[model samples]
Target chain A: MAVMQIKFIDKIGEGTINKIESLGRIALFFAVGIIHIFIKPFQGKKILDQIVFIGSKSIFVIALTGFFTGMVLGLQGYYSLVRFGSEAALGSAVALTLIRELGPVLTAIMVAARAGSAMAAEIGVMRISEQIDALRTMHINPVRFLFTPRIVASIFSFPFLTALFNVVGIFGGYISGSVILGINQNVYMGTVIESVSIEDITGGFYKALAFSVVVTTICCYRGFYMHLKGEFGARGVSTATTNAVVQSCIFILIVDYAITFFLV
Target chain B: MNTPLIQLENISKRFGNLDVLKGINLSIYQGEILVIIGKSGTGKSVLLKHIIGLVQPDSGRIYIQGELLEELPSAKIKSYQKLLSYMFQENALFDYMTIYDNIALPLIENPDVIPSRIREKVFILMERLGLRGIENKFPAQLSGGMRKRVALARALITDPKLVLFDEPTTGLDPVRKRKVHEMITEYKEHFGFTAVIVSHDIPNIFNIAQRIAMLKDGGILFEGTKEDVFKSHGKILNDFEMGKEI
Candidate 1:
């Protein structure tokens, strides 16, 4: 009985130590990846390529998801506000929700599901196939060659993508509230324009920036260190990709909550 | 005797509880082709990786041109790396890159290599390796033998003084394997670069090996020329010779 109790405590201790070690490694990896962005011989072409991949290619999906989410928000807000004799404030509620919360969070989740998974899988394949080792053997810093451009692109893409989602979502809200519901179009637009402040926009941008780093760092870290997890071949890569997307989405929500708490 | 270009002294490595290499001591001379042979998983590849800094020893020291590898500053190590190139066992070509871009990568990365000469150098090597007209194709688009030649082309493109090859001809046919051996011999003479190869090709490998090192049970069991290996016929060596164990 005593030995069993000791073994349980030891297992918990080991798990805690491993988690701390993983966090330390991730923090260091993030710092090195960001620092390489400012290093000389900048990879301008690669960064631009990645921006196209992560931002430009994501426009259609972001637009579609944003439109549907905003329609739902508008429909729900109008019915709820009507019961309170505050139907005119429906536009403000929808705008605020989309701008402050759903815009950055949903956009980040979509990008995480799409580009983040691809980044992890691509890098994980390279890791298992020894291409990363090949880069090292050639004296090329694999982090600079692989991670730096992705970091720069994510930092550039996330805010732009969030802004796109907000615009498309506002239009969708207009379609639902004014066109579908019997709300006055001018009243809806007027409330939307009046309620949104510069502080709200900037705060959303800050959240977007934070979420970008979380997504890129976690995804890239998972893929880059896939081999160290004692898995090999296709299984390692699949696990890395799945973990990257799952972790990125989880961290996005966690970071969103923390940022919102401080901002509020 | 001349000073060895690279020397390993009492090197040891352990992966978890398994000791992949134990007390490994070896010397590699300049401009010589040294082949290391052993059974699979005997750390032949690990020993080669140690030379190229892909893996570091758990204990002991490695010296390159009389300078201890671990003691050198990072910049000095990079400079040392400029003098070396490694060809991986799986021909680790960038699948996304074209054949031309793959071969020209090292040259493009080196600040000293003029940008204008990269095209000419790549084309010349491609032609020499019989890889012309396929420069725009990606690595996955090429056959296995063609990919191996492309890997060889990339390794030699930098004009390195020391080249390390890890199982360069692992899955080739007999004709392609002989062709690869011939290419290694011909290139060694043409460029005069020291070569260290990890292979299991046995008698076929002996043709180009100026010196051979046989690794077994986590250490070098024999280190000498082919003639010396044949003369020193212990039971273990006989097992290796008769293709019974190795």
Candidate 2:
């Protein structure tokens, strides 16, 4: 009983600390956002580079994930609907799921795992090497100079990425149902277009916005506070990167559930 | 000469059970080379960190130009940070950025500096440091001594009132170490900024240090002019001179 009580108390303490850290991260994100407004985005060649990085380069992964997600939904919904003799409802199920939940959550997690971790690692390395401190001594706020562009880019790009995912996913479902399962092309297309409401689309977009903030904030926080109380080396940086991804993934899921619950 | 530019009074810092700096008091004058010598793990770096407000003292007061640093707001503290520069032990040049970018970082970050003028200043510093042609080269591509020089150039780029060097010559060959020592002297001469160097290289520092402070067991064991330091027969000083622990 005593050990259990101790564990409970420890958990409460941990939760409180996490809450404070979350608030701090929110403040940092807003701070970066404010700074980004003052600084102009990359000009000419640099703008082209960022466009290639955040948009064109992400196409293959985004499309692949979207397609697989749609096919999986089609396959699963088909079996469940057949039990109820409502197999035609597969299109509705696939469309709703793709727009309301899978679109934002999956894309966010994928980006967090790939790009977010890399950003954390890059910034973490900079922190440990005193490059961040060098920036401060030079009178440059690291938040404004280093983090603003990333946060701004993520906010700008993530919703579009989710939209791309949703469109591709619905098409994948169509290909699987119509081309492979012998459903009529007109029926599949009509069901997807008609069943996917504006509410569903708007809900997904909102979740994408939240997911972008969560992932970017967590990744930036992990990098910013990489060495808080003690000295952390390469191993620490790697661990922080891993933790950032895992935490962001978990946060994405929880936020997805909350948004879905409220939207429904 | 006219009230030391920086002062630490009753400064103490403890990391858990270990006390790193114990009630240390010192004052640093402008345009003077103050070398702090001690054995490894003697809190030399910690002392230097306190001066720059990087690590706050546990129970003491730090003043820059008679202004209490710890009591100041963060924005006020930030302004003070601009006047001081620290060259880390590892020559902490950002590895991902090119040499020119690393040197230009301070200028780029300062809101007061225009981007066009920043570029000009960076180029000028690069030229002066004999690093003009290697602007695109990363720190990984530079030699250890060259990296140190680049870091020094970055520190001096801001034209700071004070510059802190933490083990500036630790991992270099003798020739390279001498080169760094000479560079420190040259920078002091050129910029006329106060310097606080933490090092174990006694002979090299003796050439430039106007005053010397020896740290041991989280306290200042001795502090005086170079002539006084050499003339003293204190046991710890003598032991340190003879490469033995007291």
Candidate 3:
């Protein structure tokens, strides 16, 4: 019985050590990648290419999701506010919810699902295929060649995407509240304009920026270090991609909560 | 003879519970084609990786041009790395890049490189390597043999002082393999760059190899001229040269 307990404790200790090591590695990876961005010999062309891939290509999905999200919020908010005879305030509620919370969070989640997974898979494939090693031999910094541009693109992309989501979401709310529910259009627009402050907008942008860093860092880290994870070949790449998306999503929510807590 | 372009002293590497390279000591001379022959899973690629600084050894010292690799500053290390180019066994071409972009990547990344010069060099290499007219095609769009040649072109594009070829002729037919060997010889003669090749094409590789190193059981078993190998070991080297699993 004593031996069993000792063995169990030993196993737990080993797992804890491994987790700590992994966290340290990820933190170092993110730091080095961020440092590379500010170094001389900037990757302007590659950064532009990534901006097109991560930002321009994501517009359709962001618009679609934003519209539906705001519609749902308008519909749901109207029904609930009506119970208190406060349905006239439906626009403020939808605007605030979309701007303060759902806009950055959902946009990040969508981008994580779309672009983050692709980044992980792309870098993971490069890792397994020894392309990253090839870059090293050619005197190219792999982090600069691969991760720096993606991180820079994400930084330039996320807030713009969030802003787009908020604008489209407000339009969706207008469609559902004024057009469908017969609410006074002027009243709805008035309340929406009145309720949103500069703080709310800037706060949302801050969240977008934070989530972008988290998502890009985690995804790139997973892929760049896939070889060190004791996995190889296609299966390793697939596993790394899945883990990148899942971890990004989880961290998004966690970061969202933490930011909201501090902001509120 | 000339302070050995690269030297490995008592190098050892361990992956998990397995010892990949156990106390390996070898020297590579400048301007010579040294082919390392070994069985599969015998750490040939790992040894090559150490020379290129891709894999750090657990216990060892590597000297580049009589200077300890580990003791060099980061800037010096980068300069040394710039002097070397590695061709991966699997032809690690960027699948998303066109053949032109793939061959020109090193130069494109170099801030000192001129745009016109990059195009000129890339086109010349493509023509010489018979990769013309396919410059716009991605690596995945090319055949295996064509992809190998593209990789070779990319490796040679920088005019590196030391070129590491990891199984450069692995997936080629006998004729293509011989052609690749001929190309390596021709290019080596023209450019005068030192070459280190890891291959299993024993007799065929012998044609271009100025010196041969046989790696077995995590250490170098023999290191000398091809004639030295043939003359010294009647059975072991003969079996290895015959593609027998020793």
Candidate 4:
């Protein structure tokens, strides 16, 4: 039993080391992908197509997430305001929380779960079938030829998406407070605009950037190195996609907390 | 004569506990076709990977033009990458790209190769390989023979010093296999590039290989000229020749 315990500990240590090494490779690939943007200019149509797929197609989900997130914030803020005998401060509370913390983090988690998983699966299949190797043999770095454009598009698009989320979320809170809860519209808007600083908006943008980096890096890493050998096929690709989504969602939450802790 | 262009000295590789290659040693001069024959899972493809630095050996050394491969940094390794091309067993064509884009990929990615020259070379190679009209078609739309030809065209686009073919005729019908063999021979004659092909197609490959290396149990069992291989009397070779265990 003692020997078995020792072996278990050793296995855990090895697993930890493996995770660290994988994360290091992910960082390296992310840097390589960023550098590739300047080095190899792709066709404009390809870039535009990716933008449409990743950004425009994602708007509805982001808006839906924002609406629910704002409603929850308003409900929670109203209860807390009533406890403090300051119901008028509900608008300020909702605005501050949404712009500072919930907006970017929630939107990123949703998109990463939905779109990032599909990207990983597609690329993972490409990797397993030697399509990535073919690209290498053809003289194109897979990072440049395949991943960089997507990464760049995500970097630009996610922040814009986050901003859209914040806007829709604030409108959601406005509808909930002014129309349903019988608060004045002018006062609600004024309180929200006053309570949320430019710094808060900037912080959300920073978090969006970090979340973009995490999502794309994890997804691309899982796809690019799906299996060490060729044994795993479609099943492996599916596993990689699931892992990418889950890992990136966890990473976004953790990084959001860390960034908010430091910035706010 | 001139210190063989490529050399493998006691190269060994392992995946976890399973040893894939056990001390492989071989050499090939420039402009020669060396066919490697082995049953499935005997590391024939693994050996080809080591030649181009796609898979590194656990021990031993590989030399291309006498420069030790493992010692070179990645930037230098990439310089070597440009000089070699590998055609995967499944043809591994990028399914998303059209045949023309797939063929043009290597040329477009290499900074030294200009676009106009790349276009010219791609069209010329397409004509040569009988892929002239289907340049815009995706790999999914093309027949197996055409996909193999596109793969060949991509491999040759860079004018690599060495071209590696992995099971080039494994899935094709006999007629398609013959056409592929003819293409291989024609390309070898036209470009004079060194070719290393891994195949179990004994009867078909015998005509193309100047020399043949037979591998079994993670090591080379026999290495000799085609005539010598046929004349040699060993159970493994005899079984392979008789199509017993292939």
Candidate 5:
């Protein structure tokens, strides 16, 4: 029994040390990855390619998500405000909710699920196939060739996706409030226009930008270092991609709350 | 005496509890084909990776072109990488790229090579490799032999002085294997580049290898010419010669 207890304590100590070491490596990957942005010999073509992938290809999904979210917000806010005999505030509530929170948060989640996961899987496959090692052997830096553009593209895409979501969601909210609920159209539009200030809008952009960096960096880091775990072949890539998506989602939520807290 | 183009002194590496390479000491002459052969899981690839500075040694040193690899700064190391090319065992072709683009990558990355020169070099290589009509097709569309040839083309496009090949003929058919071996020999003769090959091709590689290094039990059991290995007697060497892994 005493020996068992000693073994358990040793396992805990080892686990803690492993966690610290992993965190340090992650921090190092991020520092170098971000610092590469300012350095010369940037690949303009690669960046453009990634932007087309992460930004343009993502528009349809973001629009659909935003429209549905706005409609739901308008429906929910109307019912809630009616209880207090203040149904006039329904438009403001729907617009504020869509613009200040759901726009950035929902867009981030979508990007994480769609683009971030794809990035992770693509890179994870590259790692498993030794294509990454091939790049290094060819005297090319994989981080610069593969990753910097991805991170930069994510940074470029998220804010634009967030803005699109806000526009579509606001329209959805307006349709639900005016056409469906019989709230005055002019009054709903007016309330939404008046309720949303520049600060609230800018706060959401800040959240979107921060959340993009966190998700992309974490996902890429997971995929890039997936080989270090000593696992090989398809299982390693699958596990790496799974970890990337799950970790990206978790970080997006955490970053969202942290940014929202600061803005509030 | 041939000057040592690359040297390893007391190199040792351990992956977890397994000592993959132990006290590895060897030298490759400036213009010779050295084949390092071993059983599967004997760290032959790991040793090849060490020469290119892809895998850092846990202890010991490696010298390339008279410069200690580890002593060079990261930028210098990258520049030094231009002097060498490593053709992967798995081919490692970019699945997203066409065969033409794949071969063109090394040349395109060099700013000194203009677009016309890049196209000229890439097409010439493709033609030499019997890959003319398939330039626009992606890697997934190619056969295993074609993929390997494409990778070889990519490696040689830069005109590197030293080339490392990890099992260049592993999954190839007999005809394709012979073709690959012939290509390596022809390229070496034409380019006069030194080669460090890791293979299990046995008699097939005997014709090409200037020296053979037999690895067993995580150490060099034999290192010399093919005739020297054929005349010697050892369990590991005989087993490998007779197509058995000990």
Candidate 6:
């Protein structure tokens, strides 16, 4: 009975240590990748490719999300605010929600789903195929060759996407709040303009920027250091992709809370 | 008489519970072909990887051109990488790149070279490899043998001082295998470079290697000339190509 208890405790301890080691490695990977972005020689072509993939390719889905999100916010705001004769504040609620939280969080999560998964899959394949070793042999640093551009592209582009999401979302809110719900159009615009502060807008942009870097870094880390323990084929690639997207989504939410805690 | 191109001294590497290489001591001379033969999974390729700095040893030291590899900073190691390149057992071509781009990668990374020179070299090598008109095609479009040849072309394009080949002829047909042997000889003679090949193709390797080393259980069991290997006695010597026993 004592031996069994010791064995169980040992297993738990080893699992905890391994988890901590993985987290430490990820933190180190992110720090080095970010530092290299500034120190590494700029490759315009690679960064542009990432921007095209992560930014332009994502606009359609983001627009659709923003449209529906805004309409929901408008309808909900009308229903709730009308209960207490506070429906006049519908524009403020819509703009604040779109700008302050939903815009950054939803756009980032979408990117984590689409571009993040693809990036992880791509890098994971490269890892399994020994192409990363080839890059090293050819005197090209794999982190700089692969990760820096991606991280930079994500950091630079996600904010713009968040802004686009907010714009589309606000338009949806305006149509639902004023056009459909019989609210005053001029008052809707006026309330949003009057109530939405620069601090709130900038706060959203900050979240977008931070979330972009975190999401991209997590995806790249997952892809580059693909877990080869379980299996080592197509299944491994799929596992890495799924893990990257899931981990990136969780990181996005956690970082969202942290950024909000300090900044907001 | 020339300085050893690479020297491994009491090197060891362990992957988790397995000791992949143990107390390995080997010297690769300049401008000679040294073939390492071993059973599958005996760490022959792992030894080659250590010389090129892809996989660092757990203990002991490696010297390339008289300087300790681990002693150098990463930037210096990277600079040294250009001087030596390894052809992986799995071709390792970038999937997204075309044949032309794959072959042109080294030159593209080196800022000193002109585009015309890159184009000239790539085109010449492609012609030599019978891949001349398919520059734009991706690796997935090529057969395994063709991909291997293309990988060979990419390895040689940089004109490194030493070229490492891991199982150069295992999966190849007779004609392609012979062709690869010829390509190795031609490239070595043309460029005056050393070759370190790890293989299990006994007869074909005997045709090219000045020295042959057999590995077993993560250690060297035999090291001698091709003639000396046939004359050697032991369980390892009796074993021929790919688990064949005589």
Index of the highest-DockQ prediction? 3
* Candidate 6 residue lDDT tens string, B37-84: 877889998998888888889999888778888788988877777789
DockQ preference between candidates 1 and 2, better one = 1
Cα lDDT over the full model 1: 0.91
TM-score of each: 0.97, 0.90, 0.96, 0.91, 0.95, 0.92
Provide the lDDT at B8 for model 5: 92
For B1-246, candidate 1 gives per-residue lDDT tens digits of: 588999999999999999999999999999999999888899999998889889989998999888898899989888888788999889999999999999998887665788899999999989888999999999989988899889989999988999999998899999989999999888888888999999988679888888888899899988987678768744666677687964
Mind sharing the TM-score for model 6? 0.92
Model 4 C-alpha lDDT per residue in residues A162-219, reported as the tens digit of each score: 9999988888887777777767888888898778888999999999999988898888
Docking class of 5: medium
- Predicted complex 6: CAPRI docking category: medium
lDDT digits (tens) for residues A1-264 of candidate 6: 999999999999999998899889888888877777777346778889999999999999999999999999999999999999999999999999999999999999999999999999999999998999899898877887888889989987899999999999989999999999999999899999998999998999999999998889878888898854465779888888898898888888898899889876
Tell me which of candidates 2 and 4 scores higher on lDDT. Answer: 4
* Model 3 spans > 4 angstroms off: A1-3, B241-243
Ranking by TM-score: 1, 3, 5, 6, 4, 2
Stronger candidate by TM-score (2 vs 5): 5
Provide the overall lDDT of each model, using Cα atoms, as 2-decimal numbers.
0.91, 0.83, 0.92, 0.85, 0.86, 0.87
lDDT of 2 by residue, B49-92 (tens): 88876777889898878888767899987777878999999987
For candidate 4, report its TM-score. Answer: 0.91
Task: For candidate 3, give the lDDT of residue A103.
Answer: 98
Q: Please give the distance, in angstroms, between residue B58's alpha carbon in candidate 3 and its true position after superposition.
A: 1.5
The interface root mean square deviation of candidate 1 comes to: 1.1
Residue A153, model 1, lDDT: 98
Which lDDT tens digits does candidate 5 get at residues A83-104?
Answer: 9987788778987898788999
Of candidates 6 and 2, the better by TM-score: 6
